[model samples]
Target: MTDDQRPGEFELIERYFAPLAGPGGLDLRDDAGLLRPGRGYEVVVTADALVAGVHFFPDDPPAAIGWKALAVNLSDLAAKGAKPDGFVLTIALPRDWTEAWLKDFAAGLGTLAGQAGCPLIGGDTVSTAGPLTLSVTAFGTVPAGRMVRRAGARPGDVVLVSGTIGDGALGLAVHGPDRPGWVAALDDEQRRFLADRYLHPQPRIALAEALQRHASAAMDVSDGLVGDLAKLLKASGIGAEIDLDSVPLSAPARAALMADPALAELAWTGGDDYEILCTASERDYSALIAAAAERGVPLAPIGRIVPEADAVRYSGKGGGQGFARGSFSHF
Candidate 1:
């Protein structure tokens, strides 16, 4: 078979991507997917791109690569308190693409797509000279004027986060070779937990209802917490005081942190955590936590939104201090 005809584009789509289609997908025959927000609703859309060796290692499990691609976008929708509508996928397949890899990738993508009720809509496939690259444009629906924004945080609003922080960065450390000397402290179980975190991140879709009801402002922590928090504060025209001690940590993260206090910087500022950093009124705090709990998501209050006029701006207290690292920067 010629290079261009290697499992021809249409053949590939029909074999792999079409099975993931939802009602709006039109069975992969149409050029565009269809979705309606219905009365009293709005559409929430988010797009994320992943490149080999940049976002993830090329040798990583095909299934994991597929899962991470969709999960990251879902994290954004969840932060906005939107229900998963569906997604369109565009992929640039490199010359090395194999049928087996694509099959496993589809399986992984379908698992989460099914779990979150986000199906594959319509998209394109093309050959690329560069690395294996993938992009997904996922959409969601929310009640009119109910999608949360980072600009809504007000003074005295409680700053909260869902799930434990720092696992992704820590997991990345032990994920591959050239391990930091500090990694010596992690046991086999600890290593797996961290590695799993890096490989498969869980998007908090279930917490959308709670956030819609209580959040004043919210955003996903894709770029380290402190940096993402800084962005949110700037957007909201506010500052915050985060209690370093209160930042939630998984047992594996805690153990890793104890091994080398320096890891705290990464845990605080490293990227890929994908947790929701949000704010709500003090009066709504208890209810929000309870609501999140009902969904099996752990919601923790780490700080409070402060006026932008505060002299301290964004400061951390207890145990670890300083925002010197800011967050992972692409530049």
Candidate 2:
């Protein structure tokens, strides 16, 4: 089509996003969305931003980027034990934006939105000179006074995490320019497994109900187990002795570590694993495990909360070790 026939920002929204809008979206014609929590429920809101070069490679597929942008936000809601309701997206794009890219991105976003039962509400779009950026503010709901908090762990609470860790970080290494020589030791299937984990994180929304029932404190493991756990400890006024060896690792991560034991530290400190990390009392642990198992999600107990205040230590087969870095930091 000629320049005059090309779709503008508003036109694109109506064409690609309006259909995905739910009851509160008002057909993309309104300035803001209208959302009301269900009776006896409170709204839980969280926002996350992704920059093209910073959060993802510039050459990554638009669809994957779309899924990730929303998935990360959903992960936050999952940590709070809230059921997702809706989200608003704001995107700043380079001048050369094309209809094809937007179409695929919208498709990806819509698929996850439908699966999570969270529909798009409303958002802003604009042109930018720098890298593409997408921000999503997601809303969820939990029974009044039932939303989980980071500061609820008690001294005797057991530290547990959903699913295996380290896959996302290892996946990044495999996709990076200077991937370690040990990566070559991994088979083709193993390589793809790691890479896929990096591109698409499976938010543990299925475990939210169980977490609300049993967890004393909870948070998603976006930054790194070591560092994020430290944050939880600080918030809950306790310490933890994480059994580094017991920290769950995916098969691919395990294979890579076996090839190069040094990769163990990277597995511990590398970030981007969006699994839920939580603390629950021993009495509730069995029930939590049963609940998660029914949802086909694994719950691994990695450590226990301690009486000491604000300390996180790692102990492996050879005693204690120090991580080069605790977690990913942009600044």
Candidate 3:
């Protein structure tokens, strides 16, 4: 079969990208996705890109590529306490890509956009001699003057997280050949859990709005907590003391770390959780939990922000207190 004739993009898009009526009317194929924010709402925008062999592995599934591209961009809007509206896409395809691959990729993007109430309005496609790349721009709206920012944290604000951490980092450990047999023997369910965490990170969009009502400052956990929190502290001009024992972990994560002590370090430094991390005054703690409950997101208190100390500290139950290469640094 010729390249263009097999499993065309239109057919894949119809199955995955066609619009439906949810909280909003989704129209993935339309010239523009319609959005009507409530009265007194303001729009916010963020964009991100994932390049093959850099941001993602070469063998990663096409559907996953689509999901991660949109999810990462949405997390940025979520960090700003905005309601997702729609998005635009730009995809660079390798010259040898088959029509089936493009179809699956578009379908995957459509699936996520539908679930997140963000329609794919418009996009550009180009053939490239290098690796494939996907870029997405997401738009969201927040009530006038209610959007949250990283700079709002205060010295006494409590540090909190929406869900567990470290699953994605541990997943990367299993991806390598040097991993132990126990890790290599992980069952399908365990493998799938980590795989999904790495591929389809759940952007804390609804949680961002909930946080706006009570959180003094907020941001999504894109980079590991240590690195991301540093950014938060820098924005707020404060320092913090995190209880290492308080960091949450999934069942698989705990197991993987037990097999390899070094894995714990990876958990703290590894990124890609996509959960919401926030800070709020003690007075706002109960209110913040209440707001999160109303949105059906569980909020967990992980630590507290202290005065502007010269260093960040991590306190453990039996492991003592100090930063253990606490964050991921590009340099």
Winning candidate number (TM-score): 2
Q: After superposing candidate 2 on the true structure, give the runs of residues whose Cα lies further than 4 Å from its correct spot.
A: 1-5, 22-25, 327-331
Candidate 1 vs candidate 3: the TM-score winner is: 1
Q: Give the per-residue lDDT digits (tens) of candidate 2, residues 123-242.
A: 998878999999999999999999999999998789999998989999999987778899999999999999989988989999999999999999999998888988888899888877
Task: Give the lDDT of residue 196 in candidate 2.
Answer: 88
Worst 10 residues of 3 by lDDT: 322-331
Better of 2 and 3 by TM-score: 2
Over 9-81, each residue of candidate 3 has an lDDT whose tens digit, in order, gives 4454455344422345455556555656778998888888889998888677888888888999888888788
Off by over 4 Å in 1: 1-5, 23-25, 309-321, 327-331
Model 2: weakest 10-residue lDDT segment is 322-331
**Cα RMSD, each candidate:** 2.9, 3.0, 3.7
TM-score of each: 0.94, 0.95, 0.86
Say which prediction, candidate 1 or candidate 2, comes out ahead on TM-score: 2
Candidate 3 residue runs with Cα over 4 Å from true position: 1-38, 175-182, 317-331
